[model samples]
Target: MNANVTAGEAPPRAGRREWIGLVVLALPTLLLSLDISVLNLALPHLSAALGATSTEQLWIVDIYGFMIAGFLLTWGTLGDRIGRRKLLLIGAACFGAASVAAAYASSPEMLIAARALLGVSGATLMPSLLALISNMFKDPKQQGLAIGVWMSCFMGGMAIGPVVGGALLGSFWWGSVFLIGLPVMLPLLILGPVLLPEYKAPEAGRLDLLSALLSLATLLPVVYSVKTIAAEGVGAKAIVALLAGIAFGVAFVVRQRRLEHPLLDLGLFRNRALRAALGVALLASATMGGITLLVSIYLQQVAGLSPLAAGLWLVPSFVLAIIGNMAAPGLAARINPAFVIAGGLLVTTVGLLLLTQANSPGGIPVLVAGYAIAFAGTSPLGVLSTQLVVGSAPPEKAGAASALSETNGELGIAFGVAVLGSLSTAVYQSRMTDAVPSGVPGTAAEGARDSLPAAADAATSVPADLGTQLLDAARDAFAGSLHVVAVVAAVAMVLYAILAVVLLREVAPAGGAEPDAEAGPDSRAGVQEDAAARR
Candidate 1:
C-alpha cells in the first residue's frame, strides 16, 4: 500500500445514517432499471397510440440506451469535479421531469426525444451512487455487502418492471409506465441533501471538452454500428463506422496517457485485480443480456403467452437473481471471490444447457427453470465483480472507475443483443424461409422470413388454413434457432468461467483485509487514507 496507509487493520464501519443514505441512493438505480424493462412491454401500446412506424418504434427504444452509453464517461468524470451528491440530485430532477414529458408525449418524435433526455439524466445517477457507496462503507466486508444491496435493487427493478408495466397498461394508457419514476424520484430529491454526504476529487482540474467529445465519438458509432449490423447485416457503412470508432478510441487513450488530469486514469488498468474484474463483468453482462432477449421472444411469440403472463413467468428468475445478489457477499466471506465467480459461471453454463431442451411450445416450464438457474448464477458475479472494480480504484477516482464499470455493462448488453441476438435471428430467418409454404404470396413469405412478430402479422392477411401452417412452421423454426443460440451461449459461459478462474486465482475474498502495506502506497494508500480521514 501507499506510505500514507495502514494495512491489516480494518477501515471504519458505516453509521446508521450512512446505511439509510444507501437506500436513498438506490432509488435512482431502481428507477433507471425499471425504465429499461418497462418500455419493452409498453412498446405495442405506445406504437399504436403514437402511430409510430416500425423505424420510429425502434428509435424510441434504441435512443435511450445509446444516449446513456455515450454520456456515462462524461457524467462520471464530471461528478468527480463537481460533488457526486450534487450531480446525483441534478440528475434526479432531470429524470423526473423527463418522465412527466414522456408520459404526456403525443407523437413518436416527442417520445423519442423524451427518452433520450431520460438517458442523458440517467448517466449521472449510476456512477455517482456506486462511488458514494465506496466512500460510505470503508470496511472491505461492509463495502461488499453495500454493493450487493445496490445491485439487488437494480435486479429487483428489472424483475418488477414488466409486471408493473403489465398492470399499468391493463388499467391506464402506455404512458403510465413512465409515471412510475415520479414517485421514486420525488423522495430521493427531497431527502438527498438532508441525508447524503457530498464528495469530490480535491485536486481535480478543468474538464477536457475535447476528450469528452472523443469518448462520445468513440462509443456512439461502435454501438450504432453493432445495432445496424444486427438489424441490416454487415455492410460497407457498418464496417466504416466500426473502424472510425476504433480510431477514435485509440486517440482517446493516447490523449489520456498524456493528460495530467485525465477523464479516466490510465494507471487504474495497471492493477491486475481491477483489469480482470472489469473483463469478467463485461462478459457476464453480455451473456445475461443475450439470454434475456431470447427468453422474452420465446415466451411471447412461441408459447403464445400474453404480456402479463410472460412477465409473471419471469418472476421466479427475478426473485432468484435478488437472492443470489444478496447471498454473494456472505459466500465470498468464506471462500475466495474467484471461486465464487467461477462456480457461478459453471452453474450458468448448466442453465444454458438446460435451455437446449426447450424444443417445443410446451417447453415453457423448461425455459423458466433454465432462466431462473442462469439468472441466479449470474447475479452474484455482477455484485462481486462490480465490488472488485470499484474497490480496487483509489478513493479520489471512484466516480471515474464506477463510470467505467457501468459503461462496460452497457457495451456488454449492446454486444449481446447485437451479436447473439443477430446470430439467433439469422438462424431463424434461414429456417423460416425453408418452412414457408410454396403457394404463399411473395409479400407474406418475405414478412414471415423477417421475424416471428412479422410472421404473426403476415398470418393475419392469409387464408385461415394457410395462416395456421405458416404460424406453426415459423414457431418451430424459431425454436430451432433458440436451441442453437443456447448452445453458443453455454460455450461462451464455459470460456468466461475459465477466464475468471485463471485471471482471479490470487484475488482474495471480499471479506479479506486490504492489500499489504509492503506492496507500496500507490496500490491502495488512497483508499486507506480516505477511510482514515473519515474515522
Candidate 2:
C-alpha cells in the first residue's frame, strides 16, 4: 500500500489521507507559481534598491525558471529511483532556505544566485507532486479531478502573485516578497512524511550523471545565446555559445538513444500526438511569459499605475484562464480535441491582434481585454495538450511524459522572457536614440535610452518640458515594441493552430474514444488505457 503499486485495475478510490496529502502538495505548487510572478511587481523596487541594470534585472527575473527547466528531467528521474515523498521533503527544505537567502540578498548578484538555487530546488517538487497525484488517485475521474485542483491552485497563484507581492511591497521592502515561500514550505516539510506516500519505480535504473550534465550544458548555453543575441546582436560570443549548445544537444539526444536507462526516453517523440502537443505547449508558454513581463512594465512605467493597481488589473485575465482550464476537458469531450485547440489558438490570435493596437497610455482597457481573451483562449492548451501528451505515452513512461511536458513549460516561459524581453529592449533602445530631446546631460540621456524605468528616473533630473518629451518617447518606443512582439506571437499561434489541425487531427476525442487505426500501436494502446481508466 505504501509503495502505491497497483496490479491491474485503477487503485481504489482515494481516501482521506490521499486528499489531505493533496493539500500538502498544493503548498509547494502555489509557492512555485508565486515565485514566477511575484517579482513582476517587485522588480522596479529591487532594481532601484540594488541599482540593477536591465540585463541583470532580466537574469534575476528569469534565471530561476531556466534553472528549473534544466534540472527537471534529472530530478524527475531521480525521484523514480529514490522516492517521491523523500525528494519532495528534501526540496521543500531547500526551497525554504533559498527563499530566505533571496529575501535577505544584499545585491542583484546575490539575489540571482539565491533564485538559481530556488529553481534547482523547485525542480524536485513538481514531478514528485504529479507522479504522486497519479498514484494517489488511480481512478481516472479522481485523478483528473485531483489534477484540476492542483492546476487551479497553480493558476490561481500565478494570477494572484502580483497582487500578493504588491500588497507586501506596499507595506515592506522588496525582499519581503521572497519570504512568502517560507510560511508555505515550512509546514510541507513537517507534514509531508506523515501525509504523503512514498513511491519509487521498482525497476528504476541508476542515475545518469553525464546525461544530466549534457542536458544542462545544452539548455543553458542556447538560452544564453538567445539572450545575448537580443542584448548585443549577432556576435562571436553569441554564435559560439549557440553552436556549443547545439552540439551538446546533439550529444544528449544520441546518448539518450544509446542508454539502457536514459534520463529521457527519446522514443516518446515518435508519437506524433505527444510531439505536437508539447510543441504547442512550449510556444504558448513562451507567449504568455513574454506578455506577462511586457504588460507588467507597461502597467507600472507607461500607464503610471501603482504596483497594487497594476496587479489588480492583471487579476481578471488569470481568473479567466483558470476558468478556461476548467472548461477544456468538457469542450474536448464534445468535439475533436484538434479543433478545440485550433479554436483556442484562433481566439488567442484575436487577443494578440488586439494588443497590436495598444500603442498609448489610453490603451489600458485594450490591453486588459486582450490579455483576458488571450489567457482564456490559451488555457485549454495547458490542460488538453498535457492530457494528449501523457495519454499518448505508455503507462510505464507516464512520468517521463509528464516531465517532458513540465520542462517544456518552464523552459518556454524563461525563453519568452529572455528572447522577447531582449527583442523589445532592442527596439526600445533603437527608438530612444532618435527620440530623446536635445540638451539632456550625457549620463541622463544614456540612462533614459537604456530602459523605460531608467527614462522615468532620468526625467526628474531635467526641466519639465524636456522630461515630458523623454518620457513620452520612451512610452512610444515600448508601445511600438509591444506591437511588434504581438504580431510575431499572433503569427506563431496561427502556425501552431494549423499544426494542431494537421498533426493532432487523428487523436481520439477527449472522453477517450479510441484513436483511429492510423495511430501508432503505442499511441493506440495508451489511448485505450486512458479511456478505460476514465470509464
Candidate 3:
C-alpha cells in the first residue's frame, strides 16, 4: 500500500512487470550514453585504419552528438503523436543497423555518415524511454524511484564507456567498439514490445513541419557555434552562427505561440515547477561539464598522471554519484523534495570549495576527494530534477517536456565548456605572459603562452633550466585557473540552490498531496487527482 493512500484510496503501484519493463527501457538509454564516450579511445585506431584527416577525425567524433541534439525535439514530440513504444522499437532497429554499418565502414566519410544516423536514432530513445516511464509508473513515489534508476544507468554508462572501449580496442580492431551496440539494441528490439506498454496522447494533432524545421534551425547553429568557440576560441564564424540561431529561435517561439499544435508545446514552460526544475538541470550540467573537462586535463597535464591513471582516479567519484542517485528518491519520499535537493546542492558547494584548495602535482588526493564529494552531492540534483521536470507536465505533454529536459542538458554542457573553458584559457595566458625565460626563442615563448599543451611542446625545444622554469610556471598557472573556476561554479551552485528551494517549495513529497496553491496556475493538482481516480 502507498503511504499516501487514504482509507478508501488506492493509487496504482508498479509491480514486478513494470520493474522488468524498466530494465528493457534502460537498454537504449545506457547504450546511447555509452556511445558518447566509447568512440573517444577508438579515435587513434580508427584514424590510422581509415586515414582520416584532421577535419574528418573531428567530424567522425563529433557528428554523433551533433545529430543527437539536432533531432531531439523532432523525435520527442513525434513519440507523443505516434506512440512511445512504437518509436522506441523503430529507433532500436535503426540504431542496430547503423551500428553495423559503422562497424564495417571502409572510409572516414562512410563512418561519419553512419555516426550521424546513429545520433538521429539515438535521439528517439531518451524521450521515448522517459515518457514511457511516465506511462508505466503512475504513483509519484514509484515514478521517482524509477527515474533514479534510469539516471544511474545513464551516468554509469558514461563513466564506463571509455573503459569498455579500451578493453575492446586491446584485442580487436577499432570497429569492435561499434559492434558493442549490436548486443544491447538487439535485445531491446526483441523484448520491448512484449514488456513495454504503448502510450500516445489522444488529442495530439499533426506535427507542425515548419516548427520542426525552425527548432532544428534554432538549435543546430547555436550548438555548432558553442562547440566551435570551445575548440578554436571566438571567431567570425562562431559569431555568425550564434546570431543566426538566435534569429531563428525567435521565429520558432513566435510560431509555437501561434500554432494550434506546436512542435514543442511552449505552454509547458508557463508551469513554474517545470521551469525551475529545468533551470536547475541546465545550470548543474553546465558547471559540471566545464569542471569535468578541466579536471581531466589537470590530471594529465598538471598532476603528471597518465591517461589511464587519471581515469582510474575518477571512478570513485562516479561510483559515489551513482550511490547518491539511487538513494535520493527514497529519502525524498519522506522529506520535502525541495529541502532534499537544496541540501544536496549545499553539499556540492562544499566540495567545490574543497577543489579550490588543490595544487599541481601534489594535489591528486585533494582533487579526487573533492570531486567525489562534489559529484555525490550532484546525484540528487540529477535524479530529482528529472523527476520534477517530467512530473510537472500534463501526461500528454510528457514527451515534449522530456525532450526539453534533454535538450537543456545538451545545451548546458556545450555552453559550460565554451564559457568556462574560455575563462581558464584567458587566466592561463595572463599568468604566463611574462613568466617565460628571457633567452627562449620568440616562437617558443609565444607558443608557451597559448596553452599548457603548447607550453609542454615549447619546453621541449628550450634550454633545460629555461624549460624547467617554464613548465613549472605553466603548471601553476593552470592550477590557479582551476581555483578560479571552482569558485565561480561554487557561487553558481549556491544561487541555483536558493532558486530551487524558492521555486519548488510547493512541490509535494512523492507520496503526499500537493500544496493547494500550486493547484491555481499549473493544473498539475487536477491531473494528479485524475490520475489517482483512474488508478
TM-score of each: 0.95, 0.86, 0.94
Where does the lowest 10-residue lDDT sum fall in candidate 3? 1-10
Against the true structure, candidate 1 reaches a TM-score of 0.95
Clash-forming residue pairs, model 2: none
Instruction: List model 3 lDDT by residue over 1-535, tens digit each.
Output: 1222333454588999999999988888888878877786788889999999999999998888888898899999999999999998999999999999999999999999999999999899989999999878878778888998898888788788878877888889999989888899988888988999988876689999988899999999999999999988999999999999999999999988898888987667766777788888899889988998899899989988755567778878878888998899898888888888888888889999999989987999999898888888988888888887777677777788788888989999999999999999998999889888788899998999989999999999988999988899899999999999999999999998998889778777775644233324434543654456576
How displaced is residue 72 in candidate 2, in Å? Answer: 0.9
Flag clash pairs in model 3: none
Tens-digit lDDT track of model 2 for 1-535: 0112223434468899999999999999999889877887788999999999988999997798678878888888787778878988898899999999999999999999999999999988887788777667754445656776778789889878877887899899999999999999988988888999887755668889999999999988887776676556678998998899999999999999899888987767876677788988898889878887798788878899877788788888878887887777667766788888899999999998898888677999999888888878887788777766655555545566667889888768767877788878888889888898998899999998988888999999999999998889899999998888888888989998998889778765543434334445654555455446546
Report, for every candidate in turn, its global Cα lDDT versus the true structure. Answer: 0.86, 0.80, 0.85
Once fitted onto the true fold, the runs of candidate 2 whose alpha carbons sit more than 4 angstroms away are: 1-17, 40-60, 104-112, 138-142, 170-175, 418-462, 513-535
Model 1 per-residue lDDT at 406: 94
